[model samples]
Target: MKKTTLLLAGLLLVSQLGMAEMKKDVKFTEKTYGVCSREMSVEVVDGKIASFSAVRGCPGNLNALSKLLPGMEVERVIDLLDDNYCSGAPLAGYTSCMDNLVEMLKYHVMGEGEGHIQEIRKNQKAGRKVVAFNGHICSGCGLCNAQLS
Candidate 1:
């Protein structure tokens, strides 16, 4: 019984230390592709989302997400929004603003998915036309218009 108690305490301490190592008190911003939202920002505090906002998108849905996402663990938010889709349109790459948020979190906060993000940024920096979906550049595209209509 004494050995069991000591083992449990040690495990708890180790878990707490691990949690302490998590990213916190940082803000991340990313430009989204193939979505109505032009950009998104997330603020994380103590390994949880402190706030989230998008520049422009479905106001109602984005507002709802803005309210709902705060206080959620970063990993949990990623899990919830991963592979989320909107409009199901080929031009949109079958991805939604929420999925973009997930990608932002994965790349910035969790240090995952950095390659794709870095590549996109690199192309943009070089003034090379970056195609977001299906060999199409998103600028002035009528695809979003079609989805809206």
Candidate 2:
């Protein structure tokens, strides 16, 4: 039964479009906390990684992400992502990242009250780009940069 289930899962994954190709330099990471799955890849141009992407799902948007991150330094990109997305690991080992993301989301909602991310969502809805970190949008809102004496 276990083998059958495994086989079926493999088949299902294979059936997914755009997954058959071997993805180059694809990295995966998972924390021991929750089920957050992050896949990242650095795009290379002129012998350097030009950009990066942290996406949910094992083989997500590889092509699009590669195109988007066209000039990022590999090490620097990995360092930036490590703080939130974590380091390389297998797809089955992403519990920690999931836990971290969930906890972060929870804390922001608790600290700032419900709908703390609502402003970012609103901006996104209005076709504005929203940059968020740890579930909080760093919109120069002064909420984060405010001096806490």
Question: Which candidate ranks first by lDDT, i.e. highest?
Answer: 1
Candidate 1 structure lDDT: 0.69
The stretch of ten residues in a row with the least summed lDDT in candidate 1 is 140-149
Shift of residue 104 alpha carbon in model 2, Å: 24
Q: What TM-score does each of the candidates earn?
A: 0.62, 0.23
Cα lDDT tens digits for candidate 1, 1-149: 99999999999999877652446667977777657788888899998999999998899999999999999999899888887767643324345787778777876777665633343343334553433455545443323432221
lDDT tens string, model 2, 82-135?
334334422122223422332322322223223212332233345433344445
Query: What are the Cα lDDT values of the candidates?
Result: 0.69, 0.38
Separate clash counts for every candidate = 0, 16
List ranges where model 1 is wrong by over 4 Å.
1-22, 88-90, 115-149
Q: How far out, in Å, is residue 113 in model 1?
A: 1.6
Model 1 error, position 124 (Å): 18
Please list the residue runs of candidate 2 whose C-alpha ends up more than 4 Å from where it truly belongs after superposition: 1-47, 50-64, 85-149
Residue 82 C-alpha lDDT in model 2? 36
